[model samples]
Each structure stands twice: as structure tokens, then as C-alpha cells.
Target: MAKAFASAGDLTEKKISFTEVGEGLYAFTAEGDPNSGVIIGDDSVMIVEAQATPRLANKVIECVRSVTDKPISHVVLTHYHAVRVLGASAFGANQIIMSDAARSMVMERGQEDWDSEFQRFPRLFEGHESIPGLTYPTTTFSDSMTVFLGSRRVDIKQIGRAHTAGDSVVWVPDQQTMFTGDIVEYHSACYCGDGHYEEWGATLDAVKSYDPQSIAPGRGDALVGREMVDAAIANTRDFVDSTYNAVKPVAARGGSLKDAWDAVREACDPKFADYAIYEHCLPFNVARAYDEARGIAHPRIWTAQLDLDMWEALQG
Candidate 1:
């Protein structure tokens, strides 16, 4: 794992990496930051997951410009994470799509999540003032929706509850490629702070059933071969399972949240020590797991103050 900020004055903007995973499908990833996907059809394009702000999204748009001049007609949000969906306005997309549950989450905790993520990752939110407001889906679905880009079929499905209650995957059956939001991460830390561990693992199983030849994960390099795709999914599952299970016993014993955090660290640090943001995400992950273990089905609202409080309580 590379240190996100190794020195005090390291202020270089992160470089975005885009890889063509299929004929017209591209995966846009940054240095363990939020990722976006692109599917170009004959007449139009569909983008998946916007960055934190318009300034950040333009970098992705520039990448798309390199490929085709077709208008980006649809922006599909895999879930309602502030870092992933707030940049929708920048694209000037005609239809912003999302799962019904994701739209609800946005209405429920969008403001709180926006504030919380801004605090956690200020670098990702460049030109923050340009963010008009919380992004809402112009089009939403209960289970799945299929859109055609000319003759190409792009199927967006709400697979299962993993990263959030409304986690979704964009499957391009023609190319046999799937863009898994945060449900799958490649060589990057899984941000399980707002995740449902048990359901997340099961969701990975559901994703595996697709047998995709290539996969674009939420972060890191795109998986090309079938073996690499499976490996990425498996690694994501292992990370979630270890984080949740490590904290579960302590949480069940009626131990303090701090104790549960320590238990998770002891169990996970050795295995996931090299992943990006491992240290930063642990406390929040433990806190969420603790709450879940205690029967909290929904993740609690995470405010900016709450983020610092938990960080200090667990890491200070």
C-alpha cells in the first residue's frame, strides 16, 4: 500500500488511470480514490459513478473525450455515496440513474454523508463550492433497468445489499464485463464503514454467478482475465469478512467500542496492512461493525464531528 500522504507538503494531484476493459467499456480509477466507469455505445455514452466534485469529474470527462465525441446521456450511480455521486451535475447528463433504495438513502442521509466525506477526504473534493447540491436520480428502478446505447445493451441491476442498501452493478453482456461499484475492490482497502458485512459477502457470491470475463472494480486497476476478476472479488470478500468477524466477538461480549476497534486491528492489521487507507478506515469500520453486531441494521449517520471523535477515540 502506498502512503496517501507521505510528507507534509506532498500536494500533487492524483493521476487518474483509465483502462479499456472491453471494446467500448473503460474503467477510470485514481489512487485509491473514487472510481468511475464508461460505456460507449453507437449514439451516446453512459457513465457510472461521478467523483466528489465537478473539477474532479472533468478529468474523467477528458478521458472520455479521448475516445468519442458522443454526448454522455446517462450517469448511473451504483449507490449514494457522496464521493461517488455528487459530481453528477458536471457531466451535464440527461438522465441520472440509481436504485430506488439509493435514492431513499440520499434523501435520508445525503447531507450528513456529504459533510462527513468532505471532512474525511478534502483532497478528493477539489473545487468543493462547485458542487451544486446532493445528486438525485432522474431515473430510478426497483430491481433492474436495461438501457440501449444504439444496439448495445447496458443492464444495471440492484444485485444485493453490500456496500450500502442500494448497491448496484452495471453489466455489459455484449462485452461480458461488469462494473462493480464498491462491492468489488482491486488491491485497495475496502471502505466498510457504511457496509453490511454479512450481506456483502453474499452479494459477492451473487456477483460471481455472472461469471464476467472482465471486471472494473470501484478502485484500483481493472481486472482483465477471468482469473483476475474472481481474485478481485474474493479479495474484497475476505477483507469485509475479516473486518466484520474480527470485531464481532468483542462487540458481542459487551465490550467497549474502543475494545472492539482494538480487536479488529489486532486481527486485520497483519493481513491488510498494505492496503490504501487501512489505518484511516479501521476505526469507522469497527464502529459500524459494532453497531451492526448489536442489531443496528442501518448504519448510523456519520457527521464531521462524529468522524473526528471516532478517529481520536480509536487511533489517538
Candidate 2:
């Protein structure tokens, strides 16, 4: 367990980039940090993902104010992760939107998740005291819902289950821009602690069906072209498939979590060893893969203790 949970060691600030992917669609990417998407309509603006805390979210608000003084009318929660949803209060938006399943997860494990994630990635939760509690959605949709900012339309759809059971993405038909939460990460390790692997693959295919011209992925840089979009999808699929493939057989053989860890290292090290968060994410990813491979339908809720126990058991 020598440095099993060394997430706090990564405290360096990333270089933030605010790039306009479409006419009024923008992506605020901070190296490999969590990303936020912006859409400025004729009347108001909608922020795709809220940062970890209200204080951190203000950084995004500052960037938003630099371009347009429009009131942030909507705050969209792409999923139920605390890092992504807990900062909703900062926007002071009229509506907070998320999938119904996301809301359920929040009701069930939001507090535990907040503590678990904060423990796992302290750097990401720098301003922990600023978070006001779990962010409850003002609006929840079952499958898909569309909100209009004047004549511009923003479609929010539950693109099946991948990263979580409530995985959702915001799509702009006119700009052909899609803001996928963690459903599609580019060159970043997709955290599968609470993921649904089989359903996640179909969800990625659902993302491909849109053929989006621009994609503001959950992490990493924004994908602004067809080729890059395709690459992001492919990279995400590969990460997901490789993780499950590596762990499934070991799990079927009644192997230990450490055994699954070794299989994952052998399978994913050559291809994605250098990816951001690979070291931090490997244990949790294989834990879930092991569960799913053994016919576990739903992801077991992960508490702070579970996170540490799993890491110590697998990390050597």
C-alpha cells in the first residue's frame, strides 16, 4: 500500500484553453483537467459541466463573462459525479438540468461520492469548503430534453449508460457540436469505477451516430473536426474495451483483484500507460470490470473507504 492513493501528489495547475469550436459554442479545457462547455444563445448562455466547487466554478464564470455578459440561464449536469455537478450553485442559473437517473444516483450516493472523489483527487477539489452540498437538478428528463435559448436549440439526451447509468450529452444541431460528459474522453483515462461497460460501448456508438463536427469531451482537449471526433470515440472505445477484456478472463478464472490488476497492466500499459490519470484510474477501472465480468449488473456504490481499500489491495 506504499502510495496506493497518491492522487494528492498531483497538484500542479494546468494550462487552460478557451477555444471556440462552433459559432457560439466554446470549450474550456485545462490540459487534462475536467472541461466545461459553453453555448451562447441569442438571449442567454448555458454551461455544460460545473467545476468541483463554487470557487472553482467562478473561474469558469470569469471566462464566460469575458465573452458575453448574458446571464447564465442554465447549468447542465452531464452526469452525477461530484466534481462535475457540485459546482452548480456558482452559476446562479435559473435551471439546473440532468437526467432522471443522475438525480437518483445523487439521492443515493452523492454524499459518499463527494467524499470519495475528494479523497481520490484532492487537487481537483481544491476549494472543498465552497461546495454547498449535493446539487439537485431543478429539471430532470428521462431520455432526452431540449431547451431553447431564443431561436437556438440545445438538445440534451441520455446517450445510454457508459461512465454512469445517467450518462448524458448536450447536442447543438445547428453547430453540430456535442458536449459529452465522460462518455467520450480523448487521450485521457476514462474512470470506470461506476461505469457500465457493455452499455457504455453502445453509448459510444450512439455518440458516433450523431457524426458531430465538434465535440467538447469530458476531459482532454476539444475535438473540433470529423477526424479528431472519430479519434476520440475510437480512443475511448479502446480504453473501455481493453480494460474489460483484460479483467474479464481473469475474473472468470476466480482471479484476485491483484491478478486483474496485473492483466490490466499487461493489456493497457503498452497502449495507454502514458495517458492522464492512468496510474490513478487503473485499480478502480479493473475493480468494476471484474464485477461486471462476474455478472454484476449495477456498479456497486463506491465510498471513500472502498476507494482506499481497493487501491491498497491492487496497487502493491
Candidate 3:
């Protein structure tokens, strides 16, 4: 039988865990769902990724309130995916930040992404109606910028393109902890629908160079040691390599998208079958990889209808 479209069938709520990866640093993880990072400075706080909606963002707020009452002063969005940015309004942060490239994506395809993802993962958007509109960053930097929460320093930098063109990693130099947005996932699948497969490994290498003692990844558990942090980075690299390498040959041979899908499934399933969102991400990953293999450097925007069409073509 065909699989349920995207994550539509994944309605069961996951257990939420608020893990402290470092001193005053927390990772808000809900099983393998999208995770958010909390960095507590000497005075206020900085949030890594906003949840999908205001209701969901409130959950993160609750976790933040439990630990410290420092006002959430800044929100740094790692990329422009709707699930990551739409909840910006709830933070009431004075500064909502993103990379310049990420802001361009928000202007280019934010609404399409919102519509597409809402139809794809209903559970994430529990309070979709509450999202004010497309989220735009109040401040954008080209490469790197540092923000100070009182005496604490948080560095936000656009290391390289991996998950999205404007991927940013939040670095707390004092703790040697990094909040790597979708660029590095633990056991969860990397949604390559808007990814740069060729550039992703290099970006991972840059992330590795930091030698973070702790890493709050995009999904899965909060990594608290060099051993676990290295493991997650290696696993994420393998997942990207496996998916792209599988599709490249198919596209090189002038095969169909279905052929690429089958190739990717054969290459990835044995290793990543148990990964969270693996099924939901497979078709889109294969589709993008196929396009990239055929010399498409930039990924095409995904609309709600394109999602259904591609799913039907691949899994129907």
C-alpha cells in the first residue's frame, strides 16, 4: 500500500523534552520533531528556531519560563522554512534575525512553503490560524553577527549552505556549544527538498571544525558530549551522502524520477528506515537530488499541488 501523504498520518503527539546541553543552554525537543534551542545569557535570552505556530511556540516559552524569567529578547532563525519561522510573532522578541539569503527566500517562497507544509504536516501546525503571516526577519546579516545578552555572547554565522541557502549556526563560544539548525540532524531525516546536496558535506565539515562540546541539533536528542556530537554529525553526513549518491547515478543514466526514488529507497532504507520523518522526506529528497544531478543548482519552490503531484507520481 502507498504511504500516507507526507506527515498527514503522523497525528500522534510526541513527548517533549527540555534538555540542558550546557550551562544555561537548553534544547526543546519533541521526540524527532523539529527542535528549538534556548540560550540563556546573563540578562535576557535568545531563541534558536521558532516552532510552527504560536501555540507551539508557547510550549517553548513555557520551558523557557521554567528555567529563567529572562525575557526572550532575540530570535535567530536558522533558515526560512515556514515551520521554523512562522511562529516569530509569539516570541515578542525585539529582534527577529535571519541571514540575508534566508530573508530572500522568505520573499521568494515563504507563502508557498507555508501552504505546502501545512498540508504536509498537520500536526506541527496545531494552531496554524494563529500565525500572523509570512515571517520576515527584522535584521539580516550577510555572513556573521554577534549579539550580546548582557555579558553573554552569542555568535550567529552563515557557515555554509546545507539545509537551505541561508543556513545559520548559533555558536556560544563560552560553552563551545552550537545550535545547528537543520544543517545537522541526529536520527531524523534531513529534508533535502530545499537542500544543497553538493554543498552540504562541506558545510558539515565547517560545523565539525568548531568542535562543539555540545550541539542542539535540528531534531532528535540534544547532544551533550563530543562523542555524541561527533556521532550525530557523522550520521547526518552519511544520510546526505547516501541519498544524493543513490540518485546521481539514476539521473546520470537519464532515468525517471521513479527510478531515482527506487534507487534512493534501496540505498537509504536499510540504514535510515527507522529515522523520524524518513518516509515523509524521501520523495522530496529524491526529487531534488535528481534535479541536482541533472545540473539544477537551485531547488525549485514546492507548492501544495506540486507536493501532491510528486507524491502521486513517486508513490502512487
Candidate 4:
């Protein structure tokens, strides 16, 4: 029998947890669900990665309230994914910031991406009606931007492309804490359907340069120690590299996309099968890896129809 499309069968709700990884730095994680980071600056608060909807985002907001009553002054969207940015309205932040590349993606393919992801994972879209429509960045930066919440400093860089062309990370220099979106998952699947494989690894190198002591990943628990943070970076990088290695040889030998995907799945499954979103991300990750292995540079924009067609062709 063929597998279901993406996460269509995943309907159970996940438990949420908030961890204070450092002074005023918090990680809001929902078991294998989408994760968020809360940064309480001296005077205000900044939330990294809005949840999938206003209702869902409120959950994060509530978690933020638990520790600090500071206003959510800035909402940082590390990338332009529907599940990450659509809930920006809830925060009423003074500024919604994103990389220029991400802003461009929002204008170019935001709606289509929204439709595709909404259909792929219904559980994540539980409060779809709460979204006010496509969310746009109030402020856009080209490479890097620095913001201050009183005495605290948060540095955001449009580091090399990883999860998307506009992927970025939030760095807290004083506390040595980094909030990496989907770019560096901890024991969780890295969704690469829109990723740049080679550049993703290079971007991980940039992240490693920070030598962060505490790291908050896009989908997993907060890493409070240096060892855990390093392991998460290595784990994410290895997953991307292994996929490329397995798929590249097959593509070079003129094998079909399905052949390349099967090869990678065979090789990567043992190590990553139990990870969060592993099952749902596999087909899409393989599809993108197959294209990159065969020399494609920009990842093709995924649409609702593309999701079904590709799933049927590759999975069915």
C-alpha cells in the first residue's frame, strides 16, 4: 500500500512546553509541533517564528505572558513559511521583520505555499480562519540587522540559504543563545522541499562559528548545553549531506528521481525515522534533493496540486 500524502493522517494534538534556556530567553515547543522562541529584552519582548494561526500563536503569547509582561514589540520571521508567518497579526508587533529574500518569496509564492501547506498538515492549520490572510513584513533587511530591547541586543543575519532563500537566525550575543528556525533542527526532520542543500551545509558552518552555548531549534527542545547545541548542528548538517550524497550518485548515473529518493530513504531512515516530522518530510525532502542533485539551483515553488501529484507519483 502507498503512504498517505504528507501529514494528512497526523491529527493528534501535541503537548506544549516552554523552557527558559537563558536569562530572559525562552523556547516554546509543542512536542513534534512547530516551535517558537521568546526573547524578553530589557524593556520589550520579541517573538521568533509566529505559530500557524492567531489561535495557535496566542498559545505562544500566553507562554510569553507567563514569564514576562513586556509588550511583544518585534516579531521576527526567520523565513516565509505560511505556518511561521501567517499569525503575525496576533502580536500586533511594532515591526514584523524578515530578510528581503523572504519578503520577496511572500510576494511571489506566499498564497500558493499557504494552500499547499494547509492541505499537507491539517492539524497545523487548525485555526486557519483566524489568519487575516497573507502576512507581510513591516521591515525588510538585506543581509543583517540588529535590534535592541533596552540593554539587550539581538542580532539577526540573513545567513547563507538553508531552509529557504531567505532563511535567518536570531542571535543573543550576551547570553550566547541562538534561535535557528528550520535551519537547524534538534532530532527533528529538516524540511528541505524549498532548501538549498550545499548552501544549507555552509550556513550551518556560519551557525557553528557563533559557538553558541544554548540553542533553540525550529522544532525540538531547547539545547541548554554546548554539547547538545553542537550535536543539533551536526545532526541537521549530516541529514542534509547524507541526502545529497545518496541522491547525487544516483542522478549522476542517470537514475530516475524515484531511484534517487529510494536510495536516500534507505540510507537515512535508520538514523532519522523516529525524529519529529520525519515521515511527513521524507518525500518532499527527497524530491528537492533529487532536483538539486541533478543540478537545479533554485527550488521549484510547491503548490497544492504539486503536492498531490508528486505524492501520487513518488509515494503511490
Across 1-316, the per-residue lDDT of candidate 2 in tens digits comes to 3664837678888888898999989999997889999999999999999989887788898888889999999999989998898888989999999999999999999999998989987888887887888899999999999999999999999979999999899999999999999999989999999999988889999999998999999999989999999999999999999999999889888998789989999999999988888888888899899999999988999999888888778775
What TM-score do all the candidates reach, one by one?
0.96, 0.98, 0.99, 0.98
Please give the CA lDDT of all the candidate structures. 0.88, 0.91, 0.95, 0.91
Over 4 Å off in model 2, which ranges? 4-6
* Whole-model alpha-carbon lDDT for candidate 3: 0.95
| Candidate 3 lDDT tens digits, 232-306 | 999999999999999998898899999999899999999999999999999899999999999999999999999
Residue pair clashes in candidate 4: none
Better of 1 and 3 by lDDT: 3
Candidate 1 lDDT at 56 equals 87
Instruction: Give each model's clash number.
Output: 0, 0, 0, 0
Candidate 4 lands at a TM-score of: 0.98
In the predicted model 2, the residue pairs found to clash are: none
Error of 3 at 278 (Å): 0.5
Relative to the unseen true structure, what is the C-alpha lDDT of residue 215 in candidate 3, on a scale of 0 to 100? Answer: 98
The residue-by-residue lDDT of candidate 4 on 1-316, one tens digit each, is 9887888898888889999999999999988777899999888999999988998999999999888888999999999999898888999999999999999999999999999999998988987887989999999999999998999999999879999999999999999999999999988899999999989888999999998999889988889999999889999998999888899899889999889878988899989989888878888888898898888988999999998988888778
Cα lDDT of model 2 overall? 0.91
**lDDT of candidate 1 over 1-316, digit per residue (tens):** 3333211123457678899999999999887777899999999999999988999899999999999999999999999999998889999999999999999999999999998888777777769999999999999999999999999999999889998888999999999999999999987888877889879988999999999999989988889989999899889988998888887888778899988888888888888888866777777788889999999998988888888777777776
